[model samples]
Target: MEALGQAITSWVLEGHIVEVPGLGNIRAEVRAKAKSDASDVSADDIFRHHLLLTPTKEIKNALNSTPINITCFDKDGNEVNRD
Candidate 1:
């Protein structure tokens, strides 16, 4: 799992789109900073990175049709019940 995560991160950092089998394509987008009159900040400092996920049709259909049970976990790895 760690290796897979690393691979995905590397791909996104390199400006490449990663396509998962049945899920979607993950890509990284750089958002430019807005111009402000009061603050003068460098473009590098204000630039932000964002991850965009485009889900596949199959995954979208599944999400719409299926009742997904999302398991929530805490920092200590304890399962948090939502019900």
Candidate 2:
């Protein structure tokens, strides 16, 4: 996750968003979408960027140790035989 954090920081500092290769989007925005015409804005008013990553089936299947087995149920609620 260090890489993700670093990428977000760099993007925010550079005043632009960065989409990591094979990863999620990271962008910065003002907190609560303050109005442009409003006054008394603080310098610390900045929204932190976030990073998201979608995992592949390899990771998901590995996490689920239990192998999947297809099954069917009959009208009486009994599991029908595959054969």
Task: Give me the candidate number with maximum lDDT.
Answer: 1
**Clashes in model 1: which pairs?**
none
Q: 1-83 in candidate 2: lDDT tens per residue?
A: 99877767876677776665644455555454465766856656655544434455565567698676788889999998652
Model 2 score (lDDT): 0.63
Question: What CA RMSD would candidate 2 show?
Answer: 9.6
Off by over 4 Å in 1: 33-47, 66-83
TM-score of 2: 0.33
Every candidate's CA RMSD: 6.6, 9.6
In model 2, the runs with Cα more than 4 Å from the true position are: 1-4, 33-83
Model 1 Cα lDDT, one tens digit per residue, 1-83: 89989999998998899998888999998777666764765667556778999999988888799876778889999998753
